[model samples]
Target: HPQNPKPQNWTVALEKYYLSTMYSLEFIIGALGNIIVVFGYVFCLKKWKSGNIYLFNLSISDLLFLCTLPNLVNSYSKDQWAESTLCHSNRFLLHANLYSSVLFLMVISIDRYMLMKHPFRDHVLQKRNTAVVVSVAVWIGVILELLPLLYFLEPVTAANNYKCLDYASSGDPVTSLVYSMFLTVFGFLIPLLTMGCFYLKMVCFLQNRSEQIRSALTLEKPLTLVILTVVTFSLLFTPYHVMRNVRIASRIPALNISGGTQRVITTVYIITRPFAFLNSAINPVFYFLMGDHFREMLMAKTRQLLGRLTTTGK
Candidate 1:
């Protein structure tokens, strides 16, 4: 008798359960947090700075991505009846929101850097119109970059069930590898480097300025925001990318990795994957923590909502 094919124990039942729970929690918290942030920026805030524009766009991206979590959770939990079209659209929106969020964060970092390092050029480069144009460009670029996935990422049968957004099951392995490489490099690495450089320059500028001048410049808020952005990217995005590459590398036949190792990689990916989505929820916390104005606006809105509820009850 032929040796039983290595028992495929990659059931991931526990992982799926955790993912479903986490996705549900993320959707509720992320949607509410991002909605508050968007409302604060759009209606409560009197003035819109360049950074505020980027934050608003980021909030929209988070909200849009959070909107898709239910479908994603369903895919993880139930039989995937999602067609190829829905799968492609979900994949596109997921990546589009992710890269666009990174781009907007980079924009915010650059805006803050310029405000501190080259205050003289503020009139030309730091205008609200400039930020709006850049934001539009980012949206277009992310959409175009991910458009190919619609063609390549088709629904495929896995474990006798149809699955959507399962790139590994459907796409050309080489193409998947290339796309992951591009995403990690351009989407993660480059932006990370750029942010680091901008922050370094800002620190240098602060170092050169006199205490009185530095005190007057009052860059603590912007600096805090930069730190939060870096932390968010590091904690959420970094592990996902690293594990993704490792999983891709494990697929190579030359590596001759044991079945057990592959299983471990898959488990790690499942665990770390949701973290990328957590970024959407955590960002609103950052906004509330870092922005006094945002907090005040949120409190005022909460009070108004309570007043209306009490009046309605009476």
Candidate 2:
């Protein structure tokens, strides 16, 4: 490609150290938080709210996604995956987490709206069975949506068979750009907009209700979820999607984008990859903040364990 006449050596060096550090930190922190939440839900909490089911699924997604990061960390640190199978599977897990996280957040937003609409909890959608069915549908939908990635994402690059290149970076630029855009629009933009709409409706609903409802302390969790979703989309997803398209577009032979410009785009795209995955690390915060029952249960469990330890020490 004339646009990228020479390899940008600095990008590789940056990715090697930067992504290794980032993924290592994310894996450790994300795994701990998600694991604790999963255990807390399973062992500590007896009663399950409709929202609890959704948050539990979210925790599962984060935990599974975090599991894949060790492979990524090893690959990035060594500059190659041990095998192509590892490459493909890890990439699959990564994309699955990304799309699934946003979709679950959208569902949570809708769930919040339903909660406010039916504080008495009589709505059909608020039923525990319905939540389970919806969660199942979300997993299946995310799987079907991401199925093409397995085919399109060539695990190894032609230039370096050992290096597992992402679809946008390794495949035919025109084709990669098309598929990336498709994923962005359907997997990200639609869900993000859906979340925004529901959040707005939630805010309106809260405001229009009586002052009793307004002062009921229900605003904190929903508002926190909304702010977190917005922040995650803006800080993490947007730049990655934008720079991915830009990076692939620069690689297309017909575009004739300058070599210098291509380097800048590629560097930025590499940077965004780690930031995008930061969601896995940060998602555990939602479990603590949004689930009142969860927080109380987890704290009680911790206190109980501490009391046991103190008695043992005595």
Candidate 3:
């Protein structure tokens, strides 16, 4: 009897096209915005506050992550994985940026809440020195947390030599699922909960205050920031985590899942990935809105440059 051939998953082809397009767009938009923020911080802004320190770190993280996107875009577009060293380094930076960005966002949330609570900015954590220490600690902590991935991420193994598999697909399915679940809890869930609590408290505090107090404090800025943060998490982070865990679990042979079901899950997981990285593009909005002096200085710099260019033309 002739054997029936297994059905191929066409979603893999879809992923290459989709990711290449999304990543190319993300790299362009994210790079421009992050570069502006970084340039403004380094050149235009003179005085650095605690909040500025945190926002600057966030910009740097985004900029660094955006730098990796071009390479990723090339790989996806060509459907070719990079060499082992490049793959390892690229993936490491990607995970490092992911966790660090979340931690920095959490810090920003806490900083904003404290600013509202202690409007005069007299809290000890509001000090610039304290912010510097906290930023350093966050980088170190993210590195420690992601160090385990180095052992698990093999871009080219005996089984798969051509593709650079993600954490969910590259490593041992059972082990990867366990680690993915752990990250969802510690890396995302905890920080998300903390941000929610602080933002909720900020909202409650604002509501209780008189209209005069709200007007004087400029309630709209922080309110806008809260909305943006919530939107980013809901639209971006949540889906990625859920899909990542499910994708990894489905890969476990013990699960006895049908091939068609696995393919569907994998397609959904692939769709979530670009959204996860979309934060690099979105974080710049936070800088413009929440940064104390950032918007003003950026405008000033823009006007100055225009004036110079006009003079040069004349």
Candidate 4:
């Protein structure tokens, strides 16, 4: 008889260990950072800039994503499966935050681009009410996109343990493929393209202006911020989306994937999946590092809190 191949038990163990460690770190960093950002925007800042409104909403979305991390960490670390409702609900919240964060970031990029490229129209377009309306629309749109997950994510029992949102438990391959395609395209690709176009346009606009004009407007720092935001978004999100499509493609019967190939895909998916969650933690860092106005407010809030604490101690 031909020699039988062995399963990659070590690889699976390593992947699980990696996920458990990183998800916990991501949860701590993302939860604390997003809370501070959201609180600062709501309570510390006296007035909200149009862009701050969007950032506030983004932080809330991140916080919501972080809220799901403990359950995820528990599931991955303990290798314990979740109940059906919990599983589908967690998946729904994850996707909702993922897409909403992308959309809000896109909105911010557009807001910055318009500020740089069409300064004259800022008053008409950049308003608090407008941001509120857009934020509402974004929430509604994300909910609609992810609502199907609740219906489709059936519960399963494997090895005498119940599992929710199991890939093997998915109802129909055709339905999964269609839904995954829609998510990959609209959720990731389109928003990515939009942000890219705006960043490119803003860069071109800045380069065309004379040095004196650029300095007078103080465009360099903000331009750098834009570049950083675009780079960060690409770094964190691209892998997840690419590997997601790969996983979906592997499920097709025509592909006739080998066990080893499936193992490779599974490992890659496991690694990249957290990158989506990592986005939540990173956005607050970007705001602190690159956002001048936000940084100042954060500092002011910190000093004020410290002073009050010192007084209370006295």
Which predicted model would earn the best TM-score? 3
What is the per-residue lDDT of model 4 for residues 199-310, given as tens digits with 9 covering 90 to 100?
8887787777856684536767667777877888888888887877777777677889876787688678778888877889888976775453778988888999999999
**TM-scores, all models, native as reference:** 0.88, 0.93, 0.94, 0.90
Q: What is the lDDT of candidate 3?
A: 0.84
Clashing pairs in 1: none
Candidate 3 colliding pairs, count:
0
* 3 against 4, candidate with superior TM-score: 3
**Per-residue lDDT of model 3, residues 99-123, tens digit only:** 8999999999899888877878899
Q: Residue 105 of model 4: what lDDT?
A: 89
Stretches > 4 Å off in candidate 3: 1-9, 211-217
The lDDT, on a scale of 0 to 1, for candidate 4 is 0.77
Model 2: residues >4 Å from true position, as ranges? 1-7, 213-217
lDDT of 1 by residue, 23-46 (tens): 899999999889888878877888
Order by TM-score, highest first: 3, 2, 4, 1
Which candidate has the top score in lDDT? 3
Clashing residue pair totals per candidate (backbone < 3 A): 0, 0, 0, 0
Q: 190-260 in candidate 2: lDDT tens per residue?
A: 98888888878877766775477645576656766786777777688998889988888999999899878
